[model samples]
Target chain A: MDIDNISELIPQPVPLRDIDDSPGPCCMSFGFDLNPLIQSIEKVGLINPPLLKRDNQGSITIIIGYRRIKALKSLKADGAGCRILSGDDILPVECLLLNLYDNLAVRKLNDVEKGMVLARLIPWIKTLEIVEHYMPFLGLPSNRATLSSYLKIEEEMEVRVRESIACGQLSLRNAIMLLDIDSISRSSIIDLISNLKLTVNQQRQLIEYTVDLSHIQGRPIPDFLDDQSIKEINSDTRMNNPQKGRALIRYLRMKRYPSVSKAERKFKKMISRLNLGKTVKIDHSPSFESPYYRLEVLFKDGQSLREKLENFMREDIDSLRDPWKKKK
Target chain B: MDEGVQKYKSTKSILLQLKDIPVRAEKDDGPEEVACVSNELKRDMGKDTMHLVSYQGEFLKPCPGTKEYICCGYQILNVGTNCPLDCSYCILQTYFNRPNLRVHVNLEEQLGQVFQTIDSDPDKIFRVGTGEFTDSLALDPIIRWSETILRGFSERKNTVLELKTKTANTAGLLGSKYRDRIIVSWSLNSPFISCREEHGAVSLTRRLECARECQSEGFTIGFHFDPIIQHSNWMDEYRKTVDLMDKYIEPEGIIWMSLGSFRFMPALKPIIRRRHPETSILDGEFVLGLDGKMRYFKPIRMELYAFLNELLHQWHPDLGLYLCMESNEVWQESMGWRPETSEGLGNYLDERVRNFFG
Candidate 1:
């Protein structure tokens, strides 16, 4: 991993007009604002030279530091200092590598950008070297699977998704799950994640639920999600985002399994029928996952216990009767 | 087919002490099935590998129940930790941190303490079972657990030792004459779930046939549709199993039949996905239950139980049918009654015991 090959490209002042800002053959930068670059340059003067390439037309293109060049241009500087590659020496792969290496100092590459760059470098570089050296250097796991996923980030994902990745709002895993779904559902998921500020576990649950429900119902996730009832929760004005989220989850769960939802409604109704106040606690097992149910009644002494017992015994004990056991 | 004890490991010599059995020392580094790095090593897991490790924990623990449910007061006899038969929805896959088919050779010694504890409380019906952490009989061919435990409960007037299993490996039970208080139970699922989800277990017909054999031999048997999975035409599939049960089993000998829908810890979902990629068990709708396990929603659960309860009741009016780990409302809606508390459930089961054994 000798970096000395990049030293031959000497820094020289190139006229801002000579550098073509036209979209180059290998521009990976998207929507990167140069305000920080502009601010830094304005304070400390230009320190690091931008990596530029001179084409056969005798005009140099800003390969790596498009933001830096733009920042200099916005400051109305006539000339920009750049490490220039000239005359039949610069390969496109090297330009991609230099672009990747240049970002090593600027800012951390998000998974999407890292994926984009790794996608480019993997074609020519030996897979093992990239996995062992480049991947770890780029804060990625040194594995072919991870490298393959990052490679997919450039082509499978859209510009907005890439922006989501860059802003650290979307995870690569969610992005990958999103890719399996349609754009409409993907937007909905991304919206949920970004809006709800979904934790990692919640995001995973949401994605798995959405995908599995889609598979079961044979409907697109968003189509099922945008049902008439769920639409009300989504559009409800009285509820805050969290409340809406909770309500929508319950609605989605009900829609996903109609029988289970109905049972939940019935169980709640039964609980209300008990007429047990806050002191007289009654709760059923979670989804009947176990063989038993518990009834907890709070009492301080024998008097209270007897009272609670009386209340429980008096509350329509028909459901608790064993049909086979003879009455005394 | 006859089985052989080809390999063994133990922190004590209780397993090695068995005479006339050809027990060979395990030559592998140790049981590293969960952390094996190589693809071949991972594939080599569940490869007829058996370990007889010394168990350091309590041999008898209460069944893990949710505070909100009517958990049957079933006690677990910790004969082992992992099962030889790998069911797709088995909570043991997530319940255990270390992995392998490990038989606690110390179980024979611990049974003395367990029985002493049970004998001390003669009025309390300790409905103890050994299949909670492992199938009570799956490893019987290798470990011969029924031989060690049968006589201990042969005349225990207060307790009933249930040898619950899905395996047809019941030779150990058949050879013994101790039948005073032993219930050999089989966990039955629909044929679809049995064929698809329960790997390495004997088929439903064979399992019921084995139950028939045990029942004919003067052993009171039990049937458990403990993990009733919701599959396509599940009612038809389950009714097919019940039909076979009616054909093969005598209803009078069945002590109890428990119905439970498939429930699992959330952690098992990923493990199942990774370990069993071809499985369709996780394709159903699930929600996180109060106990942090993923369960089918209430309506779906009740629907399953209700259908089965009616069909089971139709088959036999007094099969001592009960729901395993269910709510009072579910019991009322599905089975027309509820235990309402762990003690009530225990009393109900004890009454079943008095009816069957008294």
Candidate 2:
């Protein structure tokens, strides 16, 4: 079981077409644009040959470096110098495991790709063993819950969601929630979140708001996400991605908690109804996660402070409490 | 009575292995069940198998409540860990990983211990319920938990046993003579929610019909409007359910009616989404509450509770109305008064117990 025994000192030049593109079910592909990879290969030649195994029909399926082959193919290279298996001898699990080792030592794998790897290994190895032994090398939390969660995403997720996952746009936590929704809803949700390119935390919040909104409305989530308002933000050509992201999330937040949003809106309208001078300021929590509030007034001197205090006192603070806090 | 309880499709058989089982010793299906009992058995077959092992944990624990919210100081009798009747918003979906109806086979054997704890605290009214983690009667035909629990709580003056169920599995209770302190409660929702979200559960009318039959047989009845999901025309649907309750149930015969807005752990949102793709229960307006669980926004919770409170009060002013896991401000606004503390809520319920069963 020497690890070094699996790999050899030299590689063979195998024809590009002969290296069968279909890498079977277990191959985890990054699907990156290969121009950059081709540039690197052209500049430095092949770092290491693509890993491969010879099948019964003398056809070769890639064991690793699918992208490397693609890069080489784009260059019209006739043959890839491959670290070919000695014979048609390696198990599929061994090939995947070796590839997993290659990814770990060379290019770091994202959670989604790790999920793909885990999905393949899950059918062959015991889950407890995978949870204990394999997850650590992939940098995943080594527990049955985490392992099961990743496999669920790989096996059951919609193709659109899987695409985001493949592109490293969605976190495993956010992707897991998407699975609970209908297929059409799942992709639309992933698409919205992906378009916004929200951070992992914001992505989670956005997902929470969307899922809850979907449940509360009893409408398919895609219907809510596809609202004319959100669609405008999604297709808004003027705003940047950040603006669109904020706008989409803001729309979802308002829809998700209509009462809180209404209360805050009324509170702001009443503050404006106060007819306070522009110098005075009113602020509320960005969202209703906290009920904490802030009030600010610009003052130049004691006389100005006194005048601002008088104006604030004259304003009906009780008006704010009267109805929003009051149960209808 | 079995007709009220939705019969489980016998797709899977009970995998039982208990040291105390000699009654059905001929089958010899015990060893394989023991092997499966260890949760290391993964989802190899894509189907869950029910394991009725004699659980080896404390069966009774205080209901996990957040301090930010006013708790009702209820005790949960852990008779089992999962349910068969699939509600879309059920937390049990993600709460346990190794899935199945894992009934603690020894709950019947452990009843005396739970009752002993309750009996030990005579001054303290422990409102004990077995339906927190699992439906108290969903498996009554196979588990027969009602007879054992009713037999134990028959004369326990300090404690009231609440067997909360969505099913009409009262054949066990019907056969048993002990009914003094047993509360056969049903979890109700708006007609829309009942039909749409609470899958595999008997209809609200059927549940009310079951309540009526149980009340007629001298058992005190309870009703829980737990997980009241918000939707369009929710008021009318809920009112229809209330009207049905008035039709089938005698208000005076009921000892308690609990109203709780829908709440769930944030982790459960995805689980529900995946488990029930067609579910709209998650579409409700929710906020990450003082507890990490997602709850309806305060005003929304207040509105739903206040509406149900008014409707239920109109049906009967003395339904012993209470809110479950809400802040004090919510209590005052929704129910129009605050229990103030868990002990205060406990005392309020204890007063109801004294009035009903003293």
Q: Candidate 1 lDDT, tens digit per residue, B185-219?
A: 99998889899888989999899889999999999
Please give me the DockQ of candidate 1 compared with the native complex.
0.16
Q: What is the TM-score of each candidate against the true structure?
A: 0.63, 0.82
- Tell me how far the alpha carbon of residue A13 in candidate 1 is from the true structure, in angstroms, after superposition: 13
Instruction: Give the docking tier of candidate 2.
Output: acceptable
Where model 2 places Cα greater than 4 Å from the true spot, the runs are A1-13, A24-27, A47-52, A64-68, A80-83, A152-163, A180-231, A234-238, A272-315, A322-328, B1-50
Taking the tens digit of each residue's C-alpha lDDT, what string does model 2 give over A84-197?
774446777778788777777877776668778988887788866887788887888766667767877777876677767777788777787666567887777677776678
lDDT of 2: 0.76
Quote the true-contact fraction of every model. 0.28, 0.36
Interface RMSD of 1: 7.4
- Residue pairs in candidate 2 whose N, alpha carbon or C atoms collide under 3 angstroms: A180-B273, A180-B274, A214-B283, A215-B282, A215-B283, A215-B284, A216-B282, A216-B283, A216-B284
